[model samples]
Structure formats: structure tokens, C-alpha cells
Target: MGCCSDFLQRAKPYVAMISLQFGYAGMNIISKVSLNHGMSHYVLVVYRHAFATLSIAPFALYFERNVWPRITFSIFVQIFVLGLLGPVIDQNFYYAGLKFTSPTFSCAMSNILPAMTFVMAVICRMEKVDLKKIRCQAKVVGTLVTVAGAMLMTLYKGPIMEMVWTKHVQPHRSSVPETTDSSDKDWLKGSIFLVIATLAWAALFVLQAVTLKQYSAQLSLTTLICFMGTLQAIAVTLVMEHKPSVWKIGWDMNLLAAAYAGIVTSSIAYYVQGLVMQSRGPVFASAFSPLMMIIVAIMDSFILAEKIYLGGVLGAVLIVVGLYSVLWGKYKENKDIKESKVMALPLAITCSEGNGHNMDLENEDRRERKPMA
Candidate 1:
């Protein structure tokens, strides 16, 4: 029964992980479609945060009203930083990158997030190093390998034929002349931007882990940060775009997509992630995100009609393998620690009994040796 209960507990997180993966993949498709339909990424971010703020505000008020009075300046500062790193910087960089790179590449590049987070955590002293521990060594090496995979995926664009399996494909018969002379340059720029976005996301995970220790109310904290971030995003859009027309909201599929991203993806998915993080720790929660890349790759191929290259496949595999290697190392280290503790319990009890028995024998000997008492 205990084992069954433990299994169920573990299964809950895996289920949440699957949901997050699917949610993120759907977010990729919807965001791409929305972008193609002429929605500016900046304005779309504004709408997402605006709607997410509104959606979560009521719940935060209702559930956390009594605790609202406890919020302090320090907490507010933490939330401010959280908002900047998470919703503002991370979202802006991501959308900007998406504008330049294909969804598949964006998703594949995102798999580096865990590695990035590990590096950032190490830098921040949130994680400790033990060079003697193979588990720790594996984590460090796996993180490096994952970063290398990301770099390869970003910089190396091999022949298209390597990606496509079709034999004897007809050459392009287009009589129309190409217009752009700097298309490759633009693509490269976009890929670079997306890599920056992944780095920002990785940093956000590290910050969240630190902040969660101080602010235990994940929902309330998230709501406040998101609310503030909406205002920041709006200000940014206004300053950058500077046109009144950019703020115009249209009632179309694009609007629906924005709403889905806001309400479902931003609000719901974030809350679920926070809950999972609280239960399973940051690495366990984030290790599942790479699965989103697989889902995105499949969706892009069938739905968006994007091509899957061999390099992309290899990069994706490298990322996934590296991610699991880190997680496995952590898991084994934790298991060994627990086992060591369990084994030490018997030794501890034996030592205590031996000391007590020696004391008792000494007392008896002293009592028996006492002169005619």
C-alpha cells in the first residue's frame, strides 16, 4: 500500500509534466500562427500579460486575501525581479526570437534551458559541487554536453538534403528571381536571439528557485509579478512600437490565440509549474520541458509543414540525453544519501547501546566493590 501510494504520488507529477509539454507545444503553434497573421509580438505579449493578470487577480484575492497584509517591501522587490526575469525579459526575448527562427529550431534550442539553469545555479551557489562524486561529475559534464548541442544546432546548418530523405527530388523550377540578398544573415540573427531567450529562461528558473524560498505563496506571488509585468510590457510596447494602431485589439482567431496563450498557457500552466516545483524541486520540474521540443517538432512537421533536418534530430537527441543524464545523476545521488542514512541508523543504535551497557557495567562494578556498603 505504501509503495502504491508512492507510485501514485510520482505519477501525479509526470502527468502534470505531460500537460505542460502539450501546453507549450500548442503555445508554439498558436504563437506562430498568430505572428503570421500580422500580430506584433510586442502587442501580443501585452495582451497575454494583461489577460493573465486579470484572470489570476480574482483568484489570488479570493484565496489569499487574509495573507495579503503580510506582504513586505522585500517581498515586493523579489516579485519585481521575478516579473522582470520571467514575464518581461524571458517572454520578450522568446517572442523576438520566434519572429526570426522557425518554431522547430526555437523548441530545440529551448532544450538547453536545463543546462543553463544548472550552470546559473552553480554560479549562484544554489547547488554544491563534490568532485569526488560521480553523480556531480555527470551533472557537470552533461550540462556542458547539452550546451555544446545547443551551440551546434544554432551555428551549423548542414545541407538540406541531409534533412530530407526524398531521393531524386526535382530541382527548383521557379522562374521568379529571389529578392532578398541578406536572408541568411537575418536567419542567423534570429537564431542568435533565440539562444539569448533560452538563456534568459534558464536564468528565470534559477531566480524562481531562490525566490520561492522567501515567498512561499506561489500563486499570490505569481499573480502580483504577472500583474506588474503586464504594466511593464505595455510600457515597453508603447515606447518601442510608439504607434497607437499597434494597440488596437482585433476580434479574430488571433485574439483567440492570444487569449489561449494568456489564460491557459500563462495563467494555468505557470500555476501548475509552481505547484510542481514546490513538490519536486526545480530540476525535476524543468527537466520535463525538453519533451516540449519533441511535441513541437512533430507538430511543426505535420501542421506547419516545416522540414525536420538530421542535424536538428541529432541536436534534439543530444539535448534530451544530456538532460536525462543530469537528472539521473541527481536521482542516484539522492538515493545513495537516503540509503546511507538508513544504514547508519543501525550503527548509531548499536553505539548508543554499547555506551549505555559499558556505563551500566562500570556502575555495577563500582557498587559491588564498595566496602561493605
Candidate 2:
């Protein structure tokens, strides 16, 4: 029983990461459907974050009321940027990309995030890279390989596979399958949007890491982020969407998208990720992202009856390989660093003892030499 408890404790992080990825995959699919059903991405952003703020703010206030840190001007600015990058830019562009492309494609592009975050961290000096170390070398090479995979997937789309379901029932599809010219144009455009989205996501990860160091209340921080995101989305919606009717939703997929994205993906995910980042670093939390890509691929293909291409298969494999390579390198580097630190303590103690002994012998020799005095 004790061993089982210990095992569960050890496996908790892995389980949480997998669960979070699955949640994100669901969000992508639901959002894609809602968009296809005539839901506007801009409006979706406003509703999603607004609901997120409402859902999480109470808990944050209740749990962190006593311990919440003061919100200084710098921290407020950082939080505002966080909101802009995450809820506004990243989500809006990503939703637009999904409207133009498939869920699988966008999710696959998201796999490039670990590499992006690694580069950004190194640039920010949050992560140190020792060029001579094999681990660091692998990380760099793996990042390049991941980027190459994403590019190949975006630029080259081979013939679509003749899946069994592609010819059968098309449930909840807004339009017939895309034409060659139209699909190509949209794919290119969506790929561009997704690339920017991924960059923003990476930047958010780095920023969140930095912000957490200053304000350690994870739940409260997430609530603040959600609040800021809601306000930003509101500002954007007011500027772009003029019609009041556009915001109306009675009982449709738009409501589904808003509820699911708000409650599960944004509010819960933000808080959970904050907790995870507190325990593990940002990269560790981001490493689980590839799982969502794979999940989205399956869900899109089988459920959505979306066409899968040969290039996609090859690219997904390469991205997965790169993701693992980076993870392995990071794991090895962390292990080595911990071991080195542990070994350093005993060596330090031994050196201290040796120096103390040498000092005692030198004092005795001096006393003997001055015996006549």
C-alpha cells in the first residue's frame, strides 16, 4: 500500500501533463467545429476569457486572499503583456488558422513550441547552454530538427489518404472538402498564422516563468491573467465586431466552445499549469505539448473525417523525434547537474578538513621553532 502511494506520487506529474494535453486537444477540436458552424473567432475570444475569469476569480480570491502578493506596476505590466500574448494574439491567430485549416494541422504546428521556448529561454539567459556539453548540443540540434519538420509539414502537402470515413457520413461539416487551389491558399495562410501563434505561446511560457518568480501565488496569478485577457479581448471585440447580433448565442456550438474553452482549457488549465510550473519549470510543462498534436490528429481524422496527407505523416514523425531528443537531452543535463551538486558537498567537506589539519600542523611547527622565547 505504501509502495503504491509512492508510485502514484511519482507518476502524478506525468499524469497531469498528459491530462492537460488531452484537454487542449479537445479545445482545438471543439473550437474548430464552432468556427465551422459560423462562430466568429474574435467574439469567441471575448466570451472564452470572460467566462474563464468568472470561473476562476472567486477561487483565486478565496484561496489566496491572505497570501497574495502586492501587484506592483512592473508586475501589472508583465501581466498585461501576458494577457495580450496568450488570450489575445496567440488564441485569436490560432482560432483563425483553424477556421482556414484543420485541427490536426494547427495542433501539429504547436509541437514546435518546446524548441521555440528553449531558444527564447537561452536568449533571455533563463536557460544556460554549455556548447561543450553533449546535452546542450543535442538540444540545439533537436530544436533545428523540430523547426525543419514543422516547415516541411507546412510547405508540402502530398496526396490525401483514402480513409474509410472520408467517403461516408460527413457530420456537422459546414462545407464540402476544400478544392486544390483553395486548400493550398488557406493552408499557407493558416500555417503562417499558426507559426506566429506558436511564437506567442512560447513567449508567454517564458514570461509566465519570469512573472511567477516575482508573484508566487499560482492560482491568483492565473486569475489575474484571465482578468487581463478578458479586458483585452473586450477591447478588441468592440473595435472589430460592430453588430450586437454577432454576440448572440442561444443553444449552439458557439456556446459549447465558449463553455468548454473557458471552464476547462483556460481557467482550469491556467491554474493547473501555474501549479505545475511551480513544481516543475516552464519547459517541463511545455514538453507535454506534442501529445496533444497526436491526439488531435486521431480526433480530426476519425471524428471530423479530415484527410491526412503523406507529408503530414512524415512531418509528425520528425517533430515527435525532435521533441523526444530535446526532452532526453534536458533530462540528462538535469540529472548530471544534480549528481554533480551532490558529489560536490562531500568533496567540499573533505577539502575543508584537509585545510584545517594543515593549519594546525603549521601552528605546531611555529610554536616549536619559538620554544626558546
Candidate 3:
């Protein structure tokens, strides 16, 4: 019983993160279906955030009401930008890209998010680099490889690798004359849009990190951000979508898309991922994103009868490899930083103990260093 309990404890984060990815993958596929059904992405964004706000607001009000951070102008400004970057720009462009491209392709393209975040962090002076360091070199190379894979996927479609299932399904698909030539152009356009969306997402992460320093109430902050995003999305949707028909819903896929994305991806995901990250760290939580892409690919092929291209497969492989390399580098860098802090702790304590204990401290330091060496 003890052994089983220990194993379950160790496996908790793995289970949570994998489950989170599946939730994300489902959102991608469902959102794709809704988009194909002619649902406006703008209105979808508005409704999604509205539902997210409704779901999260109760928790924030109940659990965090007493401890909520005092909202200052700086914090409000940060939250405003967070809403714009995430709900307004990132989500709008992502849905637009999904409309123009296959769910599998969009998911694959989104795998570059970590690499984009790294670049943005460096540019924003949040991350440091030393070319001489192997870990730093790995991060740089990984970013380049991820970019190259993205470019390859964008520029080269190659031939579709026929699947056993898609064989019968392709013939059943509409024989109506479809503009294949325009699809290539749209694919390129969608790739650009997805890239922009990913960049905005990365920027949101960077800014969120900065905002968290001032606002420490996680649930309340999330609720406020979602509330702000809902308002922003409403304004944007009003400007972009004039037809009231776009917002109408009658228990359809669009409603599912909005509800599932808002509750599952927005609210539940944040809560679950926070729990996992608390136990295992953010890197562990992030490492499972590639699983979402893989799950989306399989689901797309099976459900949507989407064609899997050879170039896309190869590019996805490269991106996955690069993602691991970058993650490994980050892991090593963080480990070293922690070890350095641990090493410095003894010296800090020793100095604070005054000169009388200096000799004893030196002896204890030698003892600690022996095992470390």
C-alpha cells in the first residue's frame, strides 16, 4: 500500500499534464469543426471569455475574495494588455488560422510556442545568454531548428501520405470542384497567422510573469484577466462582426466550442496546471504540449478525414526534437542555478554566524563539498 501510494504521488503530475493536453487537443478539433460550420471566430472569442469569466469568477469570489490583491493602475494596465494579447489577438488569430488550415496543422504550428517565448524573453531582457555555455547553445540551436521546421512546413507541403482510413474517405468527400491552388495560398496565409498568434501568446506569458510580481492572487488575477478579456473581446467582436446571426446559438457545435474552451481550457486547465506546476515545476507541465499536437493529428485524421502530408510529418518530427532539446537545456540551466543557490547557502549562514564560528564553518563546508565533488 505504501509503495503504491508513493508511485501514485510520483505519477500525479504526469497524469494531470497528459490529461490537460488531451483537453487542449479536443478544443482544437472541436473549434475546427465550429469554424468549418461558419461560426465567427470573433464572436466565438467573446462568448468563450464570457463563459470563462462566469466559470472562474465564482471561484475567485469565493476563495480569493478576502486575499485579493489591491488593484493598482500599473496592475490594471498589465491586466489590460494581458487581455488584449491573449483573448483579443492570440485567440482571434489562432481561430482565423484554424479556419484557413487543418486542426492538425495549427496544432503542429503551435508547438513553436516555447521557442517563441524564449526568444521574446531574451529580447525583453528576462533571459540571459552565454554562447560559451552548452545549455545556452542548446537553447539557441533548438530555437533555430524549431524555426526551420516551421518554415519547412509552411513552404513545402509535398505529397499527401495516404492513410488506410483516408483512402475510402477521400472519395466520399465532396467531388465538387474545389480550388486546390487557392488552398496553398491560404495555407501560407494561415501559417503566418498562426505564427503571429503564437508570438502574441508568448508575449502574454512574458507579461503575465511580470504582472504576477505585483498581483499574487492567482485565481483572482485569472478571473479579472478573463473578465477584462471578455469585455475586450466584446468590443472587438462588435467591430468585426456586424451580423447578429453570428452570435446566435441553439445547442450547436459553436456553443460546445465556446463552453468547452472556456471551462476546460481556460478555467480547469489553469487550476489543474497550477496544481501540477506546484508539485513538478512549470517545465514538467509544459513538456506535455507536444502530446496535444500528436493527439490533434490523430483525431484530425480520424474524425475530419484530414490528409497528413509528408512534409508536415517530417517538420513535426524536427519541431519535437528541437522542443526536447530546448526543454533539456532549460532543465539543466535551472538545476545549475538551484545547485549554486544551495552551495551559497552555507557561506551565507557561516558569515552571519560571526568570526568565532568561521573555522567550524570552513570544516563543515569541506564536508559538504566532498560529497558534491
Candidate 4:
């Protein structure tokens, strides 16, 4: 029972992270369906978070009813900022990019998060630098490689690879048009949006790490983020979405997409992510993001009939390489720190014990040498 419990404790986070990716992959499929059916992304964001707020509110109120901390202006400001960074700015830009690109393309591009987060952490002085260490050098090289991969994906679109799913595919209206002018234009535009979104996501990872220190209730914190995200998205929706018709969600696929996005992606996902971050730290939680690329690629191949491009495949390979390189470097550095502490412990104990024994001897010698005692 003890061993089984230990195994479960270790396996829980990995399960949660993988499950999160599955939710994201489903969201991508449903979202593409809704977008193709003429639902505006802006309005979708508004509704997604609104339902997310509703779904999470009851749990937050119930679980944290008595244990809630005193809310301060600073904490409220932090949560508001988190809402803007994540669900508002990050998600809006992401959807805009996805509108102009395929799910696999967007997910592959987001593989830059690990490198992006490292650079941002250094800039913010949250992470220490040691250029002499090979670990630090690996991280720097990994960041450059990841960025290069992103650029390669944006600038190049080589021959399409034939896959088995191509035979069973049905054409979708939302797929990018096959033309030099339109494809190139939309690719660049969407890539820009995705890059900005990735940066916002990386910043959020760092900010959440800091904020969790101040506001320790993970569920309540995520609930506040969703609530504020709903309001912010609505504000954006009001400015950009002028058509009341676009906001009309009926008993069709739009409602299904919204329900999936709200209940599964936003509410459940946000809560699970909060729990994981509370346990594993930000990088550990965010490192699982690359898994979405594979999930999306496979799902889109079948569901969206998206063609696989040579450049995208190669870029994704490079990005995955760089992602894992940085993670390995971090792991090695942390391990070294632990091993160093372990090695020093015995030496420290030995030095103190020897000093104590010497003092005892010296005191006894002085007493023996005393003229009278």
C-alpha cells in the first residue's frame, strides 16, 4: 500500500499534464469547427471565459469559503494582470494566430516557451547566470535554436508530405488557402501573432510563479483569474465584435464548442494547471506544452484534413530538440546543487566534531597543568 501510494503521488502530475494536452487538442478541433462555421474568435473568447467563470465559481466558493486569505489591493492587481496576460492577451492572440494557421503549426510554434521563459527569467533577474557552466551555455544555445526553428517555419514551406490520412480527409473552409500571395501573407501575419502570444505565455509562467508566493490558494487564485479574464475578454469583445448576430450562440456546434472550451479547457484545465504549478513549479508544468504539438498534428490530420509540410515537420523537430536540451540542462544543474549539498554535509559534521574534541583536550591539559586545583 505504501509503495502503491508513493507511485500514485509521483504519477499524478504527469497524468494531469497529459490530460491537459488532450483537452487542448479537443479544444483546437472544436474551435476550428466553430470558426469555420462563422463564429468570431473574439466573441468565442468572451463566452468561453464567461462559462469558465460560472463553472469554477461554485468550487472556489465551496472549497475556500472559510480558508480564504485577506484580499488586498496588490493581490487583486496581480490577479487582474494575470488575467490580462493569460486568458485575455495570450489567448486572444493565440486564437487570432490559429485563425490564420493550422492547429499543428500553432502548437509547434509554442514549443518556444521553454527557451522564451528562460530568457525572460534572466532579464527579470529571477534566475541566476553562470556563463562558465555548460548548463547555462546549453540553455543559451537552445534558445537560439528554438528561435531559428520558429523563423524557419515562418519563412519556409517546402513540399507536402503524403500521409495515410490524406485519403480519408474532407476539405474544410477554414484551412489556409493554397496560393503564394495569400498563404505567404497569412503565414507571416499569423506567425507574428503567435510569437507575441508565446511571449505573453512565457511572461505569465514567470508571473504566476511569483504570484503563487503571495496568494497561495491555487483553486481560488485560478477562479479569480477566470473571473477577471471573463471581464477583460468581454471588454475586448465589446470593442471589436459589433455584430450582435455573431454573438448569437444557438443549439448548434457553436454551443458545443463554447461548452467544451468553457467547461473542459478553461475551468478544468485552469484548475488542474494551478494544482500542478503549486506542486512542480512553473517550468515543470509548462514543459509538457510540447506534447500538444503531437496531439494536434495527429488530430488535425484526421479531423481537419490539414496537410503536413516539410518545413513544419523539420521546424517542429528542431523545436522539440531545443526544448528538451534546455530542460536537461536545468535538471543537471539542479542535481549538481543537490549533490554538492550532500557531499558537504559529512565534511561539515566532521569539522565541527574535531573542533569540539580538540577544545575538550585543551581544557583537560590546562587543568592538569594548574599549580593548585
Best by lDDT: 2
Candidate 3 ranges with C-alpha deviation above 4 Å: 1-18, 158-185, 270-290, 358-373
**Tens digit of per-residue lDDT, candidate 1, span 1-373:** 9999989976787789779889888888788778867778888888898788888878988997777546679877777877777677888888777766666667767777877777677789867778798888888877777766665665664755222422334433221123465766666676677778777777767677666777777778778777877888888887889778876777886788778888887877777877877765666667777778778876765554455566666777777777777777777776787899999999999999999999999999999999993
CA shift at 30, candidate 3, in angstroms? 0.7
Candidate 2 structure quality by residue, lDDT tens digits, 66-145? 99899999999999999999999999999988888877778878778988888788899977888898888887887777
Give per-residue CA lDDT, model 3, range 275-348, as digits (tens): 65444444345546666777776677787676777887887787777767776787788779889999999998
Candidate 3 whole-model C-alpha lDDT, 0 to 1 = 0.79
After superposition on all C-alphas, the RMSD of every candidate to the true structure, in Å, is 4.2, 3.4, 7.2, 3.3
Which stretch of 10 consecutive residues in model 1 shows the poorest summed lDDT? 170-179
lDDT of 2: 0.84
Would you estimate the TM-scores of all the predictions? 0.83, 0.86, 0.83, 0.84
Q: Give the Cα error of residue 50 in candidate 3, in Å.
A: 0.9
Decide which is better by lDDT, 1 or 2.
2
lDDT of 2 at 292: 86
lDDT-best of 3 and 4: 4
- Reference-based lDDT, each prediction: 0.75, 0.84, 0.79, 0.80
Clashes of each: 0, 0, 0, 0
For TM-score, candidate 1 versus 4, the one ahead is: 4
Model 2, residue 239: C-alpha shift (Å)? 0.5
lDDT at residue 109 of model 1 (Cα atoms): 74
lDDT of 4 by residue, 25-57 (tens): 889878877887888888888888888888888
